[model samples]
Target chain A: MPKTLEIRKLHVEIEGREIIKGVDLTVSTGEIHAIMGPNGSGKSTLSYSILGHPDYAVTQGEVLFDGENVLDMKPDERAAKGLFLAFQYPVEVPGVTLASFLRTAVNSIRKKQARWGGQPLKEISAIEFYKRLEEKMNLLQMDPSFAQRYLNEGFSGGEKKRAEILQMAMLGPSIAILDETDSGLDIDALRIVSDGVNALYGPDVGLLVITHYQRILRYVQPQFVHVLVDGRIALSGGPELAEQLEEHGYDWVKDQLGESAVTRQNG
Target chain B: MANALNFNRREGYLEKYGFHDKNSYVYRTEKGVSSRIVEEISGLKGEPEWMRNFRLRSYGIFEKKSMPGWGADLSGLRFDDLYYYVKPSDKKGRNWDEVPEKVKLTFERLGIPEAERKYLAGVEAQYDSESVYSSLKGIWEKLGVIFCSTDEALKKYPDIVRQYFGTVIPPGDNKFAALNSAVWSGGSFIYVPAGVKVEIPLQAYFRINAESAGQFERTLIIAEPGSFVHYVEGCTAPVYSTNSLHSAVVEIVVKEGARVRYTSIQNWSDNVYNLVTKRAFAYKDATMEWLDGNLGSKVTMKYPSIYLMEKGARGEVLSIAYAGNGQHQDAGGKAVHIAPYTSSRIVSKSISKGTGRSSYRGLVHVRKGAHHVKSKVRCDALLLDDRARSDTYPVMEINEDEVDIGHEATVSKVGDEQLFYLTSRGLTEEEATAVIVSGFIEPIVKQLPMEYAIELNRLIELEMEGSVG
Candidate 1:
């Protein structure tokens, strides 16, 4: 069976205040879905909830990954189960070289995969890991020195975004959530990152691109588009909906949906 | 991930280096300290009259000086209830085969013999308060280098031992120094002739097997002009119901254009009070470096110091301390620049977890008329959890013009975001915490030699095991 992520009636609250209110969605392997929303529309909160971030309390939700409830799992467990989230703002882990961190992360997931049953996975050798890392880094057009630098520390905005993509490529998750990955990229970096994602895209992976604008959609073309408003998806359509929103902005969707659909922060 | 346990203080320390062998002491002194006891210790060594009198005078100093009033709490330390001396064997072994079976096995378990065979130029294995094994490679001996126990030095090279015994750190320096001076035994005594350079490091392994006993080892090293030497020491004690005391004094003299580096990895059992005084005097154009690592002990108050006595001298100290639950690591380094054109640097890193506390207490002094002197001190601390605590107390006494001094301190907690980031990449919380901790101490760990650095990293991983609940 193809891998699937089914989020049903998910109600997430951050510090007792509801952020993602009763959201429902299903994403399957080989599908590309775009979650477009304005600021404070709960786009980030929705992604965090799916990843089981401790601060995002799931008051009522069932995030099932291939028939297994993911809401009860820890973040690492979720990652081990082939769920990867690329943060908008990557954290700086000082003194840990990016190469070592990637190796550790890869080995951790490999161990879990072995326990989860299939072919018994052996940890990747240093030479093999480095060869793959260098290949992926080259595809992303990143400097070779990037592997030796501390993870995300002293990295530029564009470098941090590229690092997120690099990790997504190396982890090879079944379902990858890109949270505002296009926010901090320049025109050149944006194309390189989109190409890198496209290279990793295949029938074995599902892509969930959560963003505020449709700029990345122009390059990576999501087949399904859902406009989230006031912590709910008020509009669901095909790729044309994203183009229409980009041409007229989110105000068009809010006006068409009605006054109730306007963002609470704006109210 | 759900089954991960929280950091247990005693388990980590007890699981590593806490296994003790049956005590096979040939002679052990009665509990507590007295003038008569000091005399008895000196008499047992069959030392010269001057040395015996020196012990007597140091005993008077110890009796007069009170306990230290600052730093880690010592009220629980019962000096009167401690065995001031415990002799493991009557004679020191010149080879591993000559050492007692149990003692040799302990050293073998600690990897002392293998390490010596592979890289070290000399080796000393101190069991309890006596040196059980001492050896120096024939190549170094042919170069007029003397490497032996302090007792053997007192017998063979009495003139050199007497000349530099208490020169750098005297008996009146502190109460612990006074006590160690009065009852010192079983420490390495090294002397390198002028123009000689011992390429490999000399290592000493100290083991405390007797419960509630004191191990006062006096180490003295003298590097003649144009010579170089590096001495490394490691210590561990067995777990006991009552507390043990480890008070040692290490002094060194680096002569003109000479250099000396001393590295100490102190991992005493939590039931031991590790109070040590280490100091070195660097002469013109000489260099002295101290690399100190403290991981275990109930309360440790040690500040390795370097005093630049002439122009062009330099000093450097890199120390790392890890405090687990119910432990207090009060460690740092001191640099006193008393001559022109001298330079010094001190870097300290500390980690505290689960009600553990680590304090960086250091001093950098540039005396008057010591112009063109430079000094820098940096301390960085990482708290593994909310219950852990860290503090920095830096003192800079710059009384000279045209001098440079810099100090930097940072206290950071293992942030939730950092943990979340690593966990999101498939690392468990425990593994993530250990990764961050290893990174935090990378600066100091990188400076250590290969074997020590690997051992330190492994020990840190052991301490970080089950750190997350």
Candidate 2:
């Protein structure tokens, strides 16, 4: 059986206002899907709802991960089921070294896996963990000193993106939703981060890359692209759709959809 | 299921160390204080005529002084309901095996002996009103270091003890200091000779095992010229329905080219009032540091102070406090610069959960003639819930035109974004909160010894459990 993440008729609200209005999507192992949209299109809200953020209320939705209803699970429980979300703007937790944070997250997930009758994930020794971390850092072109710095504290924009990719690579999730991972990166950083994400591609994992630009799609190809307009997917097509949107811009899509696709941005 | 997360189980984490036995003490004094009681205590100890007069004067001051009008609420404190003195054993023991069985069992449960064997150069275990077991390593003794109880030091090294006692912190400085001086009992006395350095830390453990008891331990430390020493003290007590009182006075002297570091961790029961006065006097080219951690108590009001009396002297205070339900930790630091080229730094961190309140009350003073002086003070507080409270009261008095002073403070709540970020990385809410809190205090926690740092982390984790939404 293949691992899958299915979001069915998802409706999310924040503070009594609906943000994600009846969106439907499904991602399976070995597939790459991209949700392309402009600002205020509810792309970030959909990702946050899938990850079970406390601020986002799922009024009517069912997120299934590996055939289990993940909407009823806590964020950590959902994460343990191999569902990862790469935040657009990662938080800065001072005094917690990146190495220590990664070790704790890995051990927590491993502990849950052991409870479900798989191989017991013994605690990783410090030396072994450091060896693995060094290898991942090298692949991402991150300096070794980054491992000892506080998690995302005072990190440059490019370093934060690379650190997120580094975490995704080390965690090896079954399905990952990258929410605007290329938002604040320059050309050099974009290529390094795109390459890091591509290097982690395998048949055992699935990827969902959400973005507003076609710039990163050039380096990391996506098989399918969906244009999210007004809290719904207005159009879905092959990789050529992203190229069309890049040339014509999201205004063309809104014009084509006409009065039915008026986007509303709320604070 | 929101109710499941808000179960209010703060007491379970601390209940393990709150067991008490009612009839364990050998002798107990009547409730309340008077000149007669002070005279009786001094006469019982066979103290010198000067010391006896000093006690009488302190008693008079304690009676005349009024209760403090600021800080934590002391309306519930009933002086007439507390036993002013309680002796748990007949005499101080030279060896652990010679201590009374009941007192020995308490220290065993607290793991004093095991800690002493592993990392300490000397150990003193005090129960109730006096030191029950005291020992110093032979190597430090061979180097002419004096490590003993305050009472023993008064009897054997009277010249040195009399020279430094009450010099740094006078009894009339505060109401609690006067009370502690009048009824002071077993505390550590340390002396490091000139040009000598003691590598390992000397440890002292204080326990209050009797109900409605008052424990007043007076500690004095003298670091001679060109010497260095580090002293650590830890306190705990059993739970009681009625409140107990703990008022200690600690004075330290640092001579020219000398250095001294004093570290204290207080985890009293919920029914104990911890009001302490600690001060140090540093001469020319001397340095002093105080690392204080307050974790448990009903109410605590302590602000460790340092007086720079000569040029090129330095002082530092790094303090942390945690206040849970029905607890108040009003603690901070004070630095007084009286001479030229003196410097100081104060860093305070506090956390409040449930209905607890944590306050930072501090002072930084630079006298008129203190030229080229520098000082910095920083205070940070974290409120875990809406009901929890925190406050910062900082006073800086600089009369010198050439002096530099800087102060910064921040109050922050646990952000939803930070929690979501950590939980999305596979950590439970409790675990995520613990990680954030430990990270918040890591700057000061990292400065502690390895064992103490580990214990502090564990304590924070326990405090974070069942504290999540």
Candidate 3:
């Protein structure tokens, strides 16, 4: 069976205020799907809800990963099921070197996989880990010194994005959700980070690129593009849809969906 | 992930080190302190007449003094219901095989002998009120280095022992210091001759096996001119229902051009009140460093101090504290610059979980005529929950015009975003919090020895087991 993630009629609310109101999407291995929407259009909320953030309560909906309901799973459990989310703003954890953090994460996911009748991932030795980490860092164009620094601490915008992609490469997730990863980057940094993401794309992983603009889409092409308006996918089409939305803003989608779209978008 | 995600039911994590055996004491003093108890302790040791008179005078001062009015609350302490001294064995053993069976079993469980065989150049094990086992490597003995019990040192090297015993920390220093002066025993006394350096660390392990017992050990280390020595002390006590008291006075003297480093890790059980006074004096061109870690104890009030008494002297203190469930850790450092060109640095990290509280109370003083002195103090505290609390009280008194002083403090709660980031990477909530905490204290933990650094991290993880939801 192929790996897949299906979000059905997802309704999410944080602090009693519904943000993601009735959203549906599906992604499969070896496919790339981009969800484009304006700011506050629930794109990030959908991504966070998929990852099982405790604050984002699923009021009414179900999320399935590989045909199993992941709605009740914890964040780490969701991660163990080969689900990854690239946060818009990565958290800074001081005192923990990047090398140690990545090692723990890799070992944790390996343990989870071993429990599911998969081949046990042997604990990587320090030399092997350093070699692999160096290879990944080189591919991502990150400095070697980053392995000793605290995770995401005192990092620039481009460094953080590259670090996120570096983790994606190390974890080898089946499905990855990139939430507004292109928001805070210059053109040069945007190109480097997009290239790093593109390098990790293969037949074993599916990608869900969530962004408001089509800038990152130019570097890393998406197979399918969906216009998210009023917490719902109002229009869906090929990669040209992203260029159309970029040229004609979100007003075109709101116009096509009439008064209800405008009311829900503002609401 | 069977054992990987076993954070929810940490049934035996913290209690692994809390095992204790039945009390079997050879000699025990009556409850509380007085001139009679002091005289009895002095007479038992058969000390010199002047030493007996000194104890009597110190006892008078202790009787007149009062409990401190600041830091942790000690109002619940019952002085009348505690034994001042309890000897576990009749005599000190020069070898591990000669030690008593029960006491030897306790040390074996604590891994003292293993550690001694591995890296320590000298080892001293203090059970209750006296050193039960003590030994020094032959190489150090050939180098004119003296490592023995304080009582033995007072008898063999009386001139050197009496010269610097109370000079660094006088008997009238504070209430706990006065109490320690009157009835102190069992602590390590080390002396390094001029131009001699001990390569490996000297270790002392203190254990309180009896219930409601007070272990007052007095340690004095003297590094002669151009000498070097590193002394490490570790402490732990078995779990007891009733409270116990641990009041110690450690005085170190670093002579001209000498260097000394003192590292201590105190992990007394929650039923112990750890009130200690430790200070060092650095003469011209000398250096002193103190690495202190406080993980256990119901309430602890200890602030290691350094007095830079001459030009070109330096001092440093790196301290870390962890307070869990019903524990209060009030620990910090102090530095006083009394001469020109003296420098000092102090860094402190603390974590408070459950309903525990941690406070950093430090002082830095630059006395008059002390010119071109530089000092910096940094304190960081992490609270695991909303109920946990932390406080920082730093005082800087600079009386000179050409001195430089700096201080920085931060108190933070574990962020939800940080937890989410770590959990998203497949780490459990408890593991994520532990990672964050270890990172927070990495600056100070890195300064510890390899074995101790690992143990400190493990202890912090055990304390952080149920801290996350």
Best by DockQ: 3
User: What is the per-residue lDDT of model 2 for residues B284-326, given as tens digits with 9 covering 90 to 100?
Assistant: 9999999999987889999999999999999999999999888
Task: Report the C-alpha lDDT of model 1 over B249-362, residue by residue, as the tens digit.
Answer: 999999999999999887777888999999999999999999999988899999999999999999999999999899999999999999999999999999999989999999
Model 3: residues >4 Å from true position, as ranges? A115-122, A186-188, A259-267, B1-19, B90-136, B205-214, B235-243
DockQ of each: 0.76, 0.77, 0.79
- Winner on DockQ between 1 and 3 is 3
- Per-residue lDDT, model 3, residue B227, is 98
lDDT of 1 at B418: 91
Worst 10 residues of 2 chain B by lDDT: B117-126
Can you write out model 3's per-residue Cα lDDT over B77-124, one digit (the tens) per residue? 887888776665533223544434544443343444454321121112
- Give the per-residue Cα lDDT of candidate 3 at A183: 83
First chain of candidate 2, TM-score: 0.94
